[model samples]
Target: MIQRFILLGEGYTDLYELFEIARTNQRRLLRLVQLDTVISGQKKSSLVVILQPAEPGKLMPLYLSLEGVYPPEEKETERYQLFEQLSHELDAPIHRLEVKPSADFNELELYFQYVIGVLRLNRFIPPLQ
Candidate 1:
C-alpha cells in the first residue's frame, strides 16, 4: 500500500475541510491523530486523518493540517476547539504524539517523508506492500 500526506495548510479555514472529509468518508476513516511538535519553544499541533487504502489503486491517504493550531494543552484556541468538535462528531479519539518540526527539514517534501517514515515505523499506517 502507498500512503501519502495530503497537507491542508495550517489549521484555520482548513478545519472545516478536514471535518467534511472525515464526515463524507466516515467508512474509510482508520485513525485520527494529533502530531504535537515544538518549534522554537512554541507548541503547535498537526491534525491527521488516516483513511483506508483505495480498492483498485491501494493508495492510502493521510490527510493533515500541518502544524495549524497552538498546543491546546498549553493554551486554549479556537482551532483546537474545532478539532475537538470534529473528533466528537466522528466519535474518533485523537491520538497525540510528539514529533520534530517540519522546519527541521530543508524542504517540505523531506519533512513529509520523515513523517511517513515515523508513521510506518510506529505501524500507524502499513508499510509498502
Candidate 2:
C-alpha cells in the first residue's frame, strides 16, 4: 500500500473541507490524528484524517491541515471543537502526539517522512511490507 500525505492547507477555512471529507466517508475513516508541536515558542496542532487504502490502487491518503491551529489544551477554538464533535459523531478516537515542527525540517517531504515513521512506530498505521 502506498500511503501519502495530501496537505489541504493551514487550518483556516480548509478545516471545514476536512470535516466534510470525514462526514462523507465515515465508513472508510481509519483514524483522526492531532499532532502537537511548538513553533516559534507557541504551541500549535495539525489535524490529520487517515482513510483506508482505496480499492485496487492500494493508495491510502492521509489528509492533513498542517500546524496552524492552536492546541486546544491551551486554548479552545471553534475549529478544534468541531473536530471533537466530528470524532464523537464518527466514533473515532483522536490520536495525539508531540512532534517536531515541519519548519525544523530542511524539506517538506522530509517532515512528512518523519510523521509517517512516527505513525508506523506507534502502530497507528501499518508497518512496511
Q: What's the distance in Å from true for residue 112, model 2? A: 0.3
Candidate 2 backbone collisions, by pair: none
Q: Lowest-lDDT window of 10 residues in candidate 1? A: 7-16
Where does candidate 1 stray beyond 4 Å?
A: none
The numbered model that scores best in TM-score is 2
How much is the lDDT of residue 23 in candidate 2? 87
TM-score of each: 0.93, 0.96
Give lDDT for model 1. 0.86
Model 1 backbone overlap count:
1
Off by over 4 Å in 2: none
Per-residue CA lDDT of model 2 for 1-129, tens digit only, reads: 888999999755799899889889888899999999998889999999999976666888899999978888788998888889989999999999999999999999999999999999998889776
